[model samples]
Target: MNNDVVVIGAGPAGMAAAIQASSLGLKALVLDEQPAPGGQRFRAIEQRYRRLRAAGKGLPASEQKGLDLIRRFRESDTRFVDQASVWDISPGGRQISYLHHGRSFTIPANAVVAAPGAYERPVPLEGWHLPGVMSAGAAQTMLKMSGHPVKGRIVLLGCGPLLLLTARQLSNAGANVVGLLQTTGPADFLRATPYLPAALRSATLLKQGLQLLTQTPLVPKVFSLTQASIIGADHVEGVNYRSRGGSGFIECDAVLLHFGVIPNTQLSRLAGVAHDWNEQQECWQPVVDAWQETSAENLMVAGDGGGILGDEAAEMSGRLSILRIAHRLGRISDQSLSKLAAPLQRGLKRLAAARALIDTIFHTPETMLIPSGDTVVCRCEEVTAAEIAAANASGASGLRHLKVQTRVGMGPCRAQMCSMAAMAMITPGIRCGQRPPPPATVRAPIRPLTIGQLAEADVEI
Candidate 1:
């Protein structure tokens, strides 16, 4: 099959890109792994909206916006493939191979938009592998999908706006949110003060943020937490935490951790695009031009997958990415492209300013990034920080070398959960004049695929 554009994801960026492509008379196809569109932010938005409306409850502004976007996407002429696991894209970004409904298929496209979205930063503390431990985002996802809050006593830990927001949402859903432990303290807020002038431009967002902080259910809250460890024998029983004030243990059935989100750069890396380390955000992101075109020709990355710019900016970026594709396809002239993109770029700039403050206020603490001792950095392979340190000490030179020595990034997740932590451990030991270690190489079959599925693939060529 061939398409003018192949969009990988159905989130804000992918849906918006497809909508823009359709508007420009381009043949666009969106491949999303979910059963429906609306990626993570709007996961099950259509279903949830119907349920909430049936119950006569008012939809939150965010959900309403997502519903509007999803509705627009559904009404657009663009094609959508749900439950489509896009396992690989050719290095040049012209060919995409995906598995849908247990059958594999390949599609050729003139341009590809990658908006796989972001994932929570992995924080591997002792006992984090316990059964009841999950990311705050995961809790929100469950609530969004099933319309039920997590059961049992919940202890929300780590930093980020999502942490506060999830706590409030869960509490409102009748979950017992017993404790909120935040790594962000007064020092982080002090650092963020300088960005307030720019952030003030988006007063509505700031107000919503303030409401989250104040409206969260009154619970045992700890700020500026220096360290934390989940305590359990088989399942999560409680969390022990240390902060500027002192130490305490929160007895809870569940521990929800959030250290903010980072770009899901695996596909971009797999596509052989150049990437740069974002020190401020503490993650690797694909190098994209002003129009969201990536280092590789005809390939673009948008949404949080490019970087953590929030959902609204993601929609703008999604639309911006398609403008270049449309121009290249002769659907729009250069002047037309520029005219259409001007407003989106301006909106992105405004959102970026507000993001600067959010990023500063919720910067992941250094201690959490570089775990030591017996902390398991690679949960999939059960690789420990001490083992990684040992490998580095034994002359494991770079990321690939360390992987060879400790099998850290060779797990089923392909280092999605552990690569950043592993990179942090490996970077500091580099000898002078030696080239810095490159990111772990991503290969084909990015997602798990059975041999039967491959054998049954229907090749269009």
Candidate 2:
């Protein structure tokens, strides 16, 4: 199985990259873990909408751009393999290994596009491990992928555009949105004003955000919440919080929490690509060159996986990446490549300006740095904040040390859920003013793979 290019992830970026590569007369293969082509943002939109209508629910407005891109990619000569997970990229990144339906196989590629996407930033809190608590992305997945809404009163908690948007979605879906707990305040808005003009370039997005924030029917809107503690034993019965007005409590059947998103860097890191700490976003971003190529030659990281610049930018970045690859492969002239890339680069810059405003406006509240006393920090390992503090007191002053001391990040999810929390606890220079600590170390099998599967893997020369 040799190919001209192999694009990992079938989202906006991967799909675009494969299509563009194929258009340039290169054989491109797209491998994705989803049963369908759309990533989380556009997850199962076409089929799920029909399911929604059959259940007597109105079809939510779909992402037309994503659907159109999917159609074009499907119609192209490129090959797409879904329900496949790439577990490793061999030395020099010229070979790819993946597992599908209990079988493992390997392929050779001239170039690889790693458009692996992003995930919601996890903020652990008291009772966050409760049965009814989930991330805002999870809630939206339920609403979009299935027509499932919260069974009873639901509360939207924390900050970010996703919080407000999910609140509106749930409200519009006829779910009982009991309240909205917002961490960001007017001061944050004032701070973000300088970047507002650039962000407002997309008037449609600006209007949609405003409507979601101001017109959502959720009641008892709580703003500038300093601290939120989920209160329940067997399950979440309500949430308690502190605000300028004093302490408050609200009863709810479920709580959807979000604090923006960070790149899903596990696989990229495992590949030993160079990474740097992004202070503004407070996460490690894979170091990519102007063409979205990483330090590793012929390996590219695009889309939210490179950095969380939104879906449109992801699509543009994908097309730009493969065009560069096409030029490198001598399929296109340098003059033609430059003609194509110049505009995409400028568009990404404008989108970056808009993203600065969004990041500033929805900045992570300081109170969410680490969980409160006794809060569960690692759901996979059932590790608590108190235990982490105990390890810290015993001289666990780094992520690796903390992991060894408390086994917080040595779980099945490979620290995806708790590494950030551990880093926050152990990162030095918090009191003094210095860059945050590096991300947790990533090792291969970036995702869990069975030994039997490894033994059965067939590699084609």
Candidate 3:
């Protein structure tokens, strides 16, 4: 009972989980790599949005929700370790092992919650390695958080709710949104609409998209997106494409391209938790039951790390996980269990409805974003997209063979920069392995420390 209950990530979902655990009178420790908590989402909102909110912070509903989240974490009691990157997780001799502080140690937590949120999945395409192309999520964060807006007349590529919405945000923020690429045709609504019955829970999401399109009718259309390749010698100067109906090039300085996100399951895979391929979402998610318990009873997963359930659902899931943890520890009576679950279950239902609508209009990666014959698939190792094609050309198809043929996945960054590109080259039907980041390779401290600092650290702490 006297062990650290570690929560990875301090994003909205992880924050909610930590607060719930502490409120239940449990000892918990949160580990995050960032100097500040608030994963990328609220972290970005904290920027210009905060200045805008300072005028009438509580007025705008969206900005207000963001503000409230920041205030809550600021007031929580969970112990936080910033700049502490959790590199690996494994079953620790009846406990869980965490590689932190550049050392491997295990904590005996009766419970553990993995709340690692989502990261932008790799966007593979022809000439995607050209300097000017980047994922929409990365561009958004750079502007919102770092105050470095992705400049120039940007061609916002990829199709999904995210792409459209991001275009609006960029346009609002004064970037020239030259083109909004659509991977799916208008017939996509017809082809995928049949899934709507199962997806109607997300009506608010569908409404939101309709509203955005209504507000800004000038969004750019597909600028030669079918099997298109961005062309440039050292930087992306333009995109050339031949759709079924048309062919042309859309010149641009930058291209903000991205599909939907995959689960940030690096730790889950490293921990050897059971995972299954979800073709639809195109990423691995942890296997959890009704209570968010993983295949291993002591381990639990919550939030987008659990799967792509959106933020509100993630908050509710965190609360639900806490309830289950309390119940398992006998902190609550059986009679009270029913009373607790009813409202929580109802809330999840509403979130489910909202999620359905989002799934429909959300971005789906077009073949243009995936690798083609001429593209250099690996950017970090500088493996040309053509070499990957040469391998695939000879029936040396699939990501494994592609990797074997070209040493794309063997660099120091260790596939972090190349795995998704390989997958993008292959068909969706092929199997892919989780490219979990190897433990942080520590280096000498920035400021050369004297024996005095080490001796002082030992003496003081």
Candidate of highest TM-score: 1
- Better-scoring candidate (TM-score), 1 or 2: 1
Question: How would you order the candidates by lDDT, starting with the best?
Answer: 1, 2, 3
Q: How many Å off is the CA of 430 in candidate 1?
A: 12
Report residue 193 deviation for candidate 2 (angstroms): 1.0
Question: Each prediction's TM-score against the native?
Answer: 0.97, 0.95, 0.83
TM-score of 3: 0.83
Clashing pairs in 1: none
Question: Ten residues in a row with the worst lDDT in model 3?
Answer: 438-447
**Which parts of model 1 have CA positions greater than 4 angstroms off?**
428-436
Q: TM-score rank, highest first?
A: 1, 2, 3
**What does candidate 1's lDDT look like per residue over 274-368, in tens digits?**
99877667778999988899988889999999989999889999999999888887889989988999999998898888999999999767666
Q: Which ten contiguous residues of candidate 1 have the minimum total lDDT?
A: 428-437
Best by lDDT: 1
Clashes of each: 0, 0, 15
Clashing pairs in 2: none
What lDDT does candidate 3 reach at residue 166? Answer: 74
